[model samples]
Target: MLRSSIYHRPKNNFAYAYDEETLHIRLQAQKGDLQDVTLIHGDPYIWENGEWIYSTSSMKLVGSDDLFDYWQAIIRPPHARLRYGFICNDGKESLTYTERGFFEDVPTHCHYYFAFPFLNKIDVFSPPSWVKDTVWYQIFPERFGNGNPKLNPTNTLSWGETPTQSSFFGGDFEGVINHLDHLIELGINGIYFTPIFKAMTNHKYDTIDYFEIDPHFGDKETFKRLVDECHKRDIKIMLDAVFNHSGYYFEPFQDVIKYGESSKYKDWFHIAKFPLNPGNQLSYRTFSFEPTMPKLNTENKDVQNYLLEVAEYWIREFDIDGWRLDVANEVDHHFWRLFRNRVKAIKPDAYILGEIWHDAMPWLQGDQFDAVMNYRFTNAAIDFFAKKQTTVEQFQNELVHVLQSYPQHVNEVAFNLLGSHDTARILTVCEEDTNRLKLLYLFQLSFTGTPCIYYGDEIGMTGGDDPLCRKCMEWDENKQDLELFHFVQKLISLRQQSPAFSKGEFSFHAINESLVSYRKTLGDEELLIIINPTNRSLKVKFPTSFADSIDLWTNKHVSNDLMLNENEFVIMRKMK
Candidate 1:
């Protein structure tokens, strides 16, 4: 039987012709219906010195939509060559072509070295539409590791002597930069930094100056270097923006606290009275009870302008990929709407992820944010597998509900994580059971929403709440958990190559309390993941149709009674 292939180019909305080599192409049709499709990749005519020069030597397979339903690849050329396109193998005399798109014209920089590539191109590749369905790793700067002693905090007492809220162990931007290769090996394409802005606390949330880079981490020049270095590796950096509040020493807050109602910043805060006594206990304010961390009066025009300007400065100057808005829901929606519009106007691809734990469908209503942190999914998985709080049915229901609730695009962009700076580490929460943790980890990574791993989760670093969980990076033998670390790396690699794991639609089959099965299918590729979260091993029966597929993790064939040992999972890929 001969397969037939067709070529079609998607409509582009913006100018600045795109390089087809940089774009991701997906072939959509019924499975096994199309004939052999050959994808011919090439560079556009570049305006070098004077005239245009056609650069060739680029070629790639029109990869299977069964493996990858969407065509996505980063277009890169030596230096800043702006012109590129592709030649499709549609069995016709003339090859189908795409207009040359400028790589520099896009808002976000592509991190090819750190990410998995559809094709190995000489030029670094940009992220295609399919890249959104990924697991992100959020790094808390001060807690990650101390790669450079010179960049240590000057005012040690400010953050305190311990590892908790009052403590500041030396963790710097260089530490993050040094570990770029480690992260790449761990399978995290995107890196999220907690707060890099200058602040008085270990957790940069109590932002002292939004404009300046924290001296403890390094100077502004060093921050830029970090961005450049990470970009070269294809890793996107997402910085934390604590816009709803400011530290006590912030200029506006200082003025309000020092001059009472007479101060111009009095309006910037929710002050209740005039002429406040310098010595008197002031009760008037917004947000939490923390006196040092004053909630900004977002209602004020000047206040809003100041914060928005700060955001623009980072995007324009640093070329940061995106911002993770802290305490996002606390601020005004009107301000967020304006803020989002401003950001998109500057960089359409720049993502704005909100930090809201509860049901965040309201924020995802529209332009407010690209996605919110998916805590419900993470929490439910932990409860079912680690804490033994509920049955697999409970976990499966919660997972289905979240996916069905949001629009396809919105759900695709959601940031899902097993652990973060604010909570206990996933491995620690699982009580250091590498096997059980592996089951939970696979669940989160393979599930529908985007998965984000805490910095140390890949290395199997463990700690409890606050200070304990905030322990320094321990590369030494006594502290390292190699088994857990390698497991994470393997899972990450599997995710990148498996189309069903990356871009497939999620559908689950409900079994008894001990077992749950889910399917992720994209065109000809079908992946079935069955998890048994209980202590006893059992033989589970699936519908008769699954009799011919091969288990992905273990290359074993399956039929009616699929056997999964205690705390084991079987990932099968159906082959026709």
Candidate 2:
């Protein structure tokens, strides 16, 4: 046995309370190093005359990447408090693994094993239950729709006009209200809007005031009506919170500039010198050197209290469903913990999403944000499906690493998005190929985590990154790709109707270099999804026993031998 390759941890994703009664333990080993693994667990306080009492539960191989094979064991600690270790096998020899080191057999003393002191239900990392079933739509307010032309800013372009970093088209809450039916018909249940607070920029990431809605969007009453309308339709609304920094025009930042060293709010920002000087040298820390966006000092107690109140006031007053914290990774974890407490106190189910673009395990421990904008998914999908820069095998390996990075509950509610305001539209990434975009959508909407569609992406809207990607909504059906829209709409409908698609265990199977196959299974319900992204037609084989499974797209039984054309796919689900 390769003792050096065996590893286990007692907290976070490695070993966590899946629920109040159940504990999910995981182990990592060099790929193909271990033949079988078992969890040797027992209550810490329970012991016999000599040996400590224990039970062994076999661990199932859950997933693998290029370097490691992951194993999982699910067991219920009778007392919710336990000590555990792993027994690793190499087909030739068996060895017991413990906190100290490897031994010939399971340790007799409880102190030698990894300890999960107690499973407090409060520490179980429970996010909102509704998130698992939601399909999110991300809207950049300035580009979505223009229902009120009267609210247009000076030099505001017409609806459907091209977008620039400085351009505004007057998309408001009333416009969102006018177009709610479009989302309803598409089966979207959650809307993740970009920052809408009062700000000078059209994107609104720089917040001049956290308490007020941008006048261009609408007054507080109009937004209230929008939220209530969405709730009536069973849709959840999540607005962006840009507490990471304050805009140049923000009151506190302005006060600091006016008073300099004697400013009462001087400590609110990270100003390096007394006299504010931007022409010679940038003295204050700003958001990426933009003098307008000054990063907030979240460590300051006054700042924390002010931000926490802003987090709660919206939920308490308008009954908003969620807050998507912008640049959340830069903000201190302590402030987020306080933010979570205050928000949850007002509304227990309010989804707190963070704008984290990478590994966010630290913030997802259930005391901070509920989920993040899943940019890992964006990068992986782009490299494989959109750019064709990676082989199918490499794509599968990247996905495995991402899935194993967090616990199953976190994965269930993790925000999954293919494209957002920060990236090129999904269709453009596919080189304007509707077929390739379809393949991307099929995988995203069917995979675990709540999927989000960037506003104009459902149709065939195509643009590059940043300013180019933030184009106006296509409301004219004559100019839209209605065919692609229907295809996406159908996928959303199928996802909402099938439990296997919305919330299910996900796994990928390696085929040849071009074909992709994955399974989504829940209880006895299972869905086998196959996609062929290459140009040549190919025939894919499914399990022989699944010959009579219903094809989710056509609602007809398909044969074991399935042939898929270029960029073709199928979703086959077994009858429950």
Candidate 3:
């Protein structure tokens, strides 16, 4: 009696039916030194459709010359799907059948065909493209709060010059999970955590170990709880994935430093004869001149495999929503290509963002990342309305270019943010102009792409950069900017009802020295937003066609026509 012999790795004891239309399988199987593996379909391996079928007739091996040796097959079934396996030709064995495994989940309903078998269970997951449309809020873990005092760093010091990077002030992951209501109140749907991986520093970007969460951040359970709670609230989490470099105490780097290149991990880094030569300065073999931040040689296969495993580990262990790849352009594309596949393979709806502040067209050509930070738009808004350094037309042009630079898919995914942890706070950028701040806030919530608001900007928080930008959360009763806060709240409410703010197609109307207007329309919804960037009150009339529009934000009905006073913005909705 020939009992069915099946070999399945990871032994989840279950599999899904594969879609006939999307039969492109990205297998991560190790092959012989021959550089390619063949799948001979149409052989009867497992009992299905009242008979056993083999491999040679099913899939055609793809990318035989490339490093990823993937395969694609198209099999049309008489009904829908069937169980099948491969006649794997690994140059040694001719008809060696891999053990029968569980069913593979198919994405959509396709005509049932004979089931196909492969080495690994085909797991279907792809990151969603709409993730970029989410409004992001970046939280600096340390300054955010101390939900639990026990998690605080051992050494605490006053806020002053020459601050030690390793010292922490008690902000933990639980703090973020607790204050999510505060963020929701501000109309942000996504949160970009600086870094939570285990490390000696408070920031944690210098990763000592990629697999473990920092005990200071409350361990794996806290992070898993945070991810679950956030998802329930319709919010997304973007973790900071620091692959550009590792901290001084990283295991692999430590191995190299201690063993003097004799260790197997020596190939993981680019080494010099005098690897620790301080005189070499910029040319030294560390990450971008930071001696503590040692750069990983991504071109090496071992390094790529290790980092990819780390990426998959998080999505599997913590169920994180997505990742913000820090210094993405600096890392090698070869590594990113493999990295993207591994990430999307786990959570097809996950998002991958790059931290490039300038034009990243070369990297965003559909293969590199889903989107990059929109510093250009943020700067333009700051200059024209906040600093008054440029004319409205210039600002308008900058906004147009931001959209035109990428495809519609990429444009909608771009992170539209102003005043991140790296820049001056929005309040400071606007020079404390309550009116200008209102206008900017109105625009951000109404503009295209995902909007990101730095913490405390709504309450008129002002800071320059670094230490100034990283102030602790101010629960001060006397200093809260209620008026500004309410205005922002109103703008956010308007955005919730306005398609132009969320998914509308945008078009520029007019942009002058002191005025700029744009229109956004999605399906049946239409909106016209006009801004006046001056101090003294200035009245501007809308076109005759939009005369019957109503100001949803202000609740001021425009029966015939409307006017925008100085520094005033009118969000007019087209009446049915």
Top-TM-score structure, candidate number = 2
Could you say which candidate leads in lDDT?
2
lDDT of 1 at 498: 84
Q: In candidate 3, which residue ranges exceed 4 Å CA deviation? A: 1-133, 157-167, 278-283, 511-513, 559-561
Q: lDDT tens digits, residues 1-576, model 3?
A: 011322222111112222332232222233222223333334233446654443445444322221223334444434333343433444543443333322233212111222344322233222265563577788888777677777766775543223343555777888888788877786777888888888887778789998888888888888889989898888888889999888888898888777864778887877665345435463336656877787888899999999899889988887888889988878988788788889988987778888888988766754567778877878888887788898766676677656644444566667877787777777887787778877887777777777877777878878887667777666564787978877877766666666666767677676344677888788777888777777666556677767767777667776543445688777777844
Candidate 2 segments exceeding 4 Å error: 511-513
State each model's CA lDDT, in order.
0.68, 0.89, 0.67
Worst 10 residues of 3 by lDDT: 6-15
Candidate 1 is scored at a TM of 0.75
Ranking by TM-score: 2, 1, 3
lDDT of 2 at 570: 79
User: Candidate 2's error at 343, in angstroms?
Assistant: 0.6
Tens digits of per-residue lDDT for model 2, 439-546: 889888888899999997887898998788998888989888989989999999888788888788999865555788888899879888889899989987788657
